[model samples]
Target: MAGPRAFAAAASLSMLFALSPATAQTPPTESIQIGLSTDAISITAGFSGADLTIFGSLENPDPLIARQGRYDVVVVLEGPPRPVVVRRKDRVLGVWINLDSEAFENVPVSYSVATTRPLQDIAEPAKYKQLSLGAQNLYMKPVDETDSPATIEEFTAALRERKTATGLYSENVGGVQFLSQNLFRATVRLAPNVPVGTHKARAFLFKSGMFVKESSAQLEIRKSGFEQSIFRVAHDYSFLYGVFAVSLAMLTGWLGRLIFRKD
Candidate 1:
């Protein structure tokens, strides 16, 4: 009877241990994915601006962490890279003239950011600098690297200011929202003067203010309607387009003189 009682006590202890929790097995690693409903977007002649919606999913998201609202997402839409020349105007004899110029290569024509929360609240500034995640943190390579750091910094700031003023560089806080535990949506603004080219859409996942995963997709922005035809002609037939433009200008001048001239 004593041996049987001891055996029963041991069995009960083992069962309690098993029921306590399963903490040994590692949780699955989380990842992020994004998709575009269409690979291309067409803008008509009257396009002022619009919102582009991006859908994404969080894979292997921890239910507890998600419930606690630790998951965050940041989405970026970056336009095609192009060389830009930023010039500074100095007042010379009361005339503002271009004085100092800085040329930057491979600069994104447009940059738009959308985030679940403010960037500062989501991650540290150092983390964002490491990831090059924001317009302010983006590195702009100057053509002349031999210049002084102060000059480069000044020009870089100027360039960013110009881009922001034109609505080419923007940040939209709270633009990303989690529809469910693992699904999310982001809306990014397309400026009226958004460039037409291949744009990259990227999504970054953060857990508890730490960067977790990243995903990206490509999107083509093209012109449509009569504007598209003109754009194609200007590029595909540059010589003929130039001739036609000059002839049209001359013809317009002649017509205006004939209609409104006083002799």
Candidate 2:
């Protein structure tokens, strides 16, 4: 009887020890989640640029890493893709002429990046290139692949410069802030001429200079009020709208002549 009792006690002790390790261990994987206050936004006419705020959270984050500030986040708002043609103008007999051109397919109309730190400090350039991130690293595939590499590179640089000048491509360092151990906020700029389409907002997480996870959300940007109505009419009734525009112009010209004709 004593031997059987001792054996049963040892077996229970072993089983408890085995289960303790499993319960004490937390999964090492961490993920990111982002949310938008609204799924769509309206842009009225004569509106200047504005900042858009995005909130996010870290899931299953390691407290130690968070406390040490080893975690980083990068947020990006990408506008809809469309075909673009980049033309180069050069002096021709003292008048600028469209000399050369390059066409690219599926170019992003706008791209805004907000990061916890400067991009170079967050990760290697190769990583960003691999992710097709940042205005400088984004890949712009040329429509004519057979074009000389030098020409393509020049046009690509020109396109990026033009977008930057227009406030369509931007980067904001230190735009992301950690509100708490697991919560973060990011602010990205929206240009006044932001395209009306479906945009995607993405968040990337990095831990100790290593990519951890990513998450995304969708947003719709569209015009509102009188401008929106006119836009819809122009697209939905092109022929009628054109006729009305022509007639209105003609009437304006005749009225101007009558109002101030030299006697």
Candidate 3:
């Protein structure tokens, strides 16, 4: 028979060998998930400007993970019938200079952000295009210009070679560029001749040439008195003002009649 002490020691050594492995294996990388919050999803249209909120998560199976890397998030505007472009430029010696190396004429409106590490990022791409209701009227205001006024030929040439159209009038004033990334603000001035109506403008984001996400808002343009009357009473003020006016008039007439009868 084996000694009790020797047998116990042997069993313990066997258990240790079974429990421990010779080499460690790395776990698989977890897929990344990106999305916008509910509050971020909803937006009000017909404003001069608005901000969009983006939130996402990078998940890894292993707790020890690397999230420090540069990423590009792009937002794109898809629609409203006529193509639109917003260009940003700097004023140098009274001349309008293109802020972005690449010209954006006939190209969709896009906003981009570059970030390092995992955290919340917030950006507001001000309004460069506003569409009117009925998809007839469109309003575009280009960023302020600083450099010398551009000639029609120069401007036309720039437009012909550009990727997007900056509506009827293009301005290079009051625009700012993103310091960290190749970002800029361009103004697009809509022609006064734009037809009045409601329009739709889409927003989208892209990264590494791949479409990532998208959103949209409505643009309500008021031009004629009839259009303005219908839009204001129906949507803007909800007919409250009209109702109050009618009620007040009725009350005043009733009081006058009662007083006259007593007299």
Write the residue-wise lDDT of candidate 1 on 1-263 in tens digits.
01111000010011112212354367767888888877888787677777788888887777889999999999999999999999999999999999999999999999999999999999999999899898999889999999999999999999999999999999999999988787788888888788999999999999999999998989898877887799899999999999999999999999999999998
RMSD of 2: 15.4
Question: Candidate 2: TM-score?
Answer: 0.85
Q: How should the candidates be ordered by TM-score, best one leading? A: 2, 1, 3
In terms of TM-score, the best-performing candidate is 2
Candidate 3: segments with Cα more than 4 A from true spot: 1-27, 39-46, 61-106, 110-114, 117-263
Error of 2 at 27 (Å): 3.5
lDDT agreement of model 3 with the native:
0.32
Output the lDDT of residue 18, model 3. 21
Residues 1-263 of candidate 3 have per-residue lDDT tens digits of 11111100010011111212332365433333323223111112222222222233322222222222232232222232334443559898999997643222232232222132111222222211221111111222223334234532344345433422423322222221222222212122233233334433332232322333443444443343454566567677867978977998999999989988765
| Model 2 residue 238 distance off true place after TM-score fit, in angstroms | 1.8
Give the total clashing residue pairs for model 3.
Answer: 41
